[model samples]
Target chain A: MGTVEFAGVSKTFGGKTVVQALAEVDLRIGEGEFVALLGPSGCGKSTLLNILAGFEQLTSGSVRFDSRAISNPGPDRGVVFQEASLLPWLTVWDNVVFGPKVQGVARSIYEPKAEAILKIVGLEGFKKALPVQLSGGMRQRVGIARVLVMEPRALLMDEPFGALDAQTRLSMQQLLLDVWQKLKTTVLFVTHDIDEAILLADRVCVMSARPGRISREIPITLPRPRSIDDLTNPAFIQFKAAIMTEMRGAHGAH
Target chain B: MPLAGQLSSSLLAFILPVSLIAFWQLSGTNGVIFGGALPTPDRVWTAWVNWAFGTPTFGLNPYVGTWLQNVIFSAERVAKGFLVAIATGVPLGIAIGWSRLFAKLVDPTIQWLRPVPITAWLPISIAIFGIRDFGAIFLITLGAFYPIVINATQGARAVDKNWIRAAQMMGASQAATLWRVVLPAAMPSIFTGLRIGLGIGWTAVIVAEMVAVKSGLGYVLWDAYYVGRMDIVLADMVSIGLLGYLSDRLIVALSGWLLTWHRLQSFNQ
Candidate 1:
């Protein structure tokens, strides 16, 4: 049910000068699989994710989720924004429960689920705190918790930990790895960090900028239940080296 | 300590007005000023006390014990008009901000008409409602509507794009998004509009009462002036100012309570 397919997808943002953001991008994500679209800035990775999330329209080609043509954003696919973007006015509890409340899920049904999700994200004590009152990492935890409460079939995360400090980023990565290990939701993670892409994703699709297209797809055979410690593993290092060379070659060709 | 600091700050703010009143009182000769064209602050105070507390003698003094009544009249008019402005302006503004088609259809008309002052509407209001409370109410509504509507539109338009996208992604219907996400996000802006709109409401009530109505503080202001009761005129002017200030305080307090999150956000920044 979490399957996603992008068939020859092309997107051009039209203005006085038309900018082609993506061209002939073909990709597929299987149910419960983790994929990362790894690229440099301006590689249209975000645009691609936005298209798949139904936040933007592709000019040509098609995107499908669960074998149906993607149209508008829905609870079936949850998106985690880079900024966390928790409703500034809502407390962590309100933000987490926002999805179920809006979808008319009975309070008796969603209340326990929300509490459990918040605990999973390590934000049980922060339920009463407003987003602004929390630190950046705490806010992101609320962000992840809010999405997790929805129990979406697929998770679309766009540079979710890009704004965190080095230490905070590592902790957040570990938290995510722990959570994703249990849930195993189909994930389409976009990131510029090579190690992050390798550590989190099963398959890393390296993308090139300027009419963004996948330059290479490297499969990561890292052991399951991976932790931040695996980042220094020799096997992980080897994969990173190969992907780095692929990125350099792709940039040179451009 | 915080309470003491607040008290001192408030007292500091009153220094200018207090000193101004003192100077005016000291400069007056026999409770008159500007060669008897204006009354001194003391004379205005005396007149105000009489106007507020004097027994009704059924005499020629129209303002005898009528201060509270006139104050109520003006306050009531402002309240009614301001409410109508909020009722219509908020929804209309939200629609204008949310939908491109709605904005294109209605925005130009509002922009064209907004610059036409509330005073300009006085003749039309009187012609229609005829020297009654409705005329003043109409003007007040017109005056308040522009700021409220404009601010609300700006507030709705300024809502973060990701907020809407997030709502949609979370299975919120379009209507639900507008109600829950867009409305709340636009709240700070809506409060801004309400404050500006309310200030205009006071101005409108005075202008309308001076021209189109026979009761209220504004009517008394003009009536006292014509009879050369400059003491009552000054007293009436003070009454209006006090009311305006109080009403504005009410709105500020309301916004403070409703927008606690927004307040925390600014403090964090």
Candidate 2:
């Protein structure tokens, strides 16, 4: 039910001088596939995700989700922002159930589901705490839990752990890996971290800035049920080296 | 009694006012100052006490014991006006901030009208609503509207884009997004407007009462001035100042409660 296809998509930002952000991008992901767009800042990686999430519109071409053209964001495709972006006024539980509650889902259906997701994210006891009182890691847990409670078919994350400390990032990555492995939701994760792309995604699409375009598509041939510990595996190291090399090549071209 | 440390912090605040009061008292003799052009604080205090608690007389003096009644009249006018301002200004401001088309259609007119002082509108208000309580309330509402609307617009406009996107992705309709997200997010700024608007409300009510209405503190101040009763005028001025301060304090307290999460976020940062 979760498939994303981008066909000849282009985006541009208008200022005194026009700058092309994305140039004729084409990509496709099958149901339940985890694809990471690996690139540096300003590479239009976030822009592409936003376009697919319907937060931004493409200058030309179309985006499809579940074989249907999508023009606006909906509960079916959940986005996890980099800064967590939990409403400062809301408590953990309120933030977690915001999606379902706003969509007018019955309390009977979402309350139990939200509770379970909070438990999965290890935030059961902290549900009453405001987002401001939470650590960055804990806030991101609420971010993930909120989307999960909506039972989205596709998860779109843009560097969800980029703002966290190194230790917190690793823990979050592990948490994400566990959740994704269990749910098998089609995922589009955007990150500049090469190790993150290799450790978490089934496929990595390397991209470059200045008229942002995909540079390479590498399939990760690693075993399932992966954890952050796999960063030490020889196969994982090989994938990281390849992604780093591709990134350097993209930078050199720029 | 307050704790010693608490008293110490507020001690600094009382210095300037207390010193000024002492100087004024000393500058006066027999509770008359500047040859009775201005009554001393003691005279004003006596007048306030009498006006506040004196029995009503069936004589020529209408303000013999009408202080509390006038106060209630003025306060009720300000309250009604400010409520009307909130009812119209907040939603309009949110619309102006949220949608460019709405702003284009309504904002310029508001900005153009905002510069016309409430005193200038006294005649037009009187013409429309007549010399009754509604005229005073209308002027107050008009006076308070500008600050409330401008502040609310600024608040709604300043909401983080990501928050809107988050709400959109969560399947919130346009109405839900405005009510559930934009309204709450804009609350801090709206409260700012409310405080400023309320200050203007007090000003408008006084102006309206002085010219259009025959009651309230403003009427008494002008009446006392004409009738050689400077004591009541000074007392009325103090009453207005007190009311303004108390009303602002009420808004601040409410904002402190409503925006607790926002306060904590800022504190953490």
Candidate 3:
């Protein structure tokens, strides 16, 4: 149900001088497929995700989600920001239930769903705590939980764990893997980290900066039920080596 | 937050005022000062006692036993005006901040009117509503509206873009987003405007009463001065200050309770 397509999409920022953020970027993800846009900073990967999330206007071309042209953000496609961006005034429970509550879902229905999602995200104990009181990783858990509670068809995550410490990031990665393995929601993840892209996605679309475009698309053939332990697997290392080489070549072209 | 600490902090605040009162008293002779033009602290206290508790003797002394009535008059006017300001200003300010079209339509008019001080509006208010409670209220509302609306606009404008996006992504309609997300997020700034607005409300009420209304602390202040009752005038001045201080504390207390999240943020910093 979560098919997405971007056809000849382009975006430009206007000022005294115009800067093209994306130029004729084309991509597609099948239902329940996990795809990551991997690139260095300023590669417009986040811009692409923002456009698909209905938060940005493409200068040209069209984006379709579930065969419908995107007009505005809605519950069908949930976005997890890098900074978590949970409303600071709201507690964990309120943040998780915000989507359903605003969408006018009955309390009888969304309340249990919210409770279950909180438990899944391991934040039932912290449901009453405000966002400011939480650690960065814990806040990101709430971010994921809030989106998941909406039961979205697709998840667009923009470097959801990029701000965490290494150890915290690994745990969060595993948490996401565990959650995604069960839900199998279509995900369009944006990140600059090569290892993260390889570890999580079914296909990695490598992007290059300066009129950002997808330079290469590599399919990860690793078996499912993945874990952090897969990071050391020889097959994962081989994929990483090839991607690193491709990334270097992409960088050299610019 | 300890009891002892809180008590000591409050007591510390009183020391300077107490010493100032003592100095004022000592510098005076026979409860009078400044060649008998000004009354001493003791005289002002005695006047307050009479004004508050003395029996009214059929217009013999208008100031006697009338303190509470005048206080209520002024406070009620301020309250009504401030409420009107909030009712009109908050929504208008939010609209101005949230919608560019609305801002374009209304914001320039408000800005043009803002620099015209409340004192300047008094003649127009008197001309329009002349010598009535509404006249006083109009002045107070005008006085309070600018700060309230400007601050609320700022609060609404400064709302984090991501918060709005998050709400949008959650399937919130534009109205729901403004109410649920923009309103709550703008609260801290709204409180700031309320405080400033209330202060101006007090000033406006005083100005309105002294000129247009026949009763209230401001009327009593000007009347007591005219009748050569320096003690009543001093007491009235002190009464106005006390009322203003109490009302400001009321707003601060309300903001403290409503903005506990904001308080926690500052504490963390």
Relative to the real complex, the DockQ score for model 2 comes to 0.86
Our model 3 lands, by Cα RMSD against the true structure, at: 1.5
Of the two candidates 2 and 3, the one with more favorable DockQ, higher being better, is 2
Deviation of model 2 at B118, angstroms: 0.8
In the range B1-269, model 3's lDDT, one tens digit per residue, is 99999999999999999998887887776445566667889989999999999998897689889999999999999999999999999999999999999999999999998888889988888899989999999988988899899999999999999999999999999999999889999999999999999999999998899999999999999888898999998999889999999999999999998888889989988
| Candidate 3 lDDT over residue span A1-254, tens digit each | 99999999999999998989999999999999999999999989999999999999899999999889998988999999999989988888899999999898999999999889888888889989999899999999999999999999999999999999999999999999999999999999999988999999999999999999999999999999999999999999999999999999999999
The per-prediction CA RMSD against the true structure, in angstroms, equals 1.4, 1.6, 1.5
Query: For candidate 1 chain B, which ten residues in a row score worst on lDDT?
Result: B27-36
Model 1 spans with C-alpha error above 4 angstroms: B1-7, B30-33
DockQ of each: 0.91, 0.86, 0.83
Clashing pairs in 2: none
What is the Å distance of residue A171 in model 3 from its true position? 1.1
The residue pairs in collision within model 3 are none
Report the TM-score of candidate 3, chain A only.
0.99
- lDDT string for model 2 (A1-254, tens) is 89999999899999999989999999999999999999989999999999989999899988999989988999999999999888888889888888888878899999999989999999999989998888999999999998999889899999999999999999999999999999999999999998999899999999999999999999998999999999999999888888888889999998
DockQ (model 1, Cα): 0.91
Give lDDT tens digits, candidate 1, residues B1-269. 59999999999999999998887877676545566667788778999999999887877889789999999999999999999999999999999999999999999999999989999998899999999999999999999999888988998999999999999999999899989988899999999999989999999999999999999999999999998899998999889989999999999999899999999989878
- Model 1's chain A TM-score stands at 0.99
TM-score of 3: 0.97
Where does candidate 3 stray beyond 4 Å? B1-6, B30-33
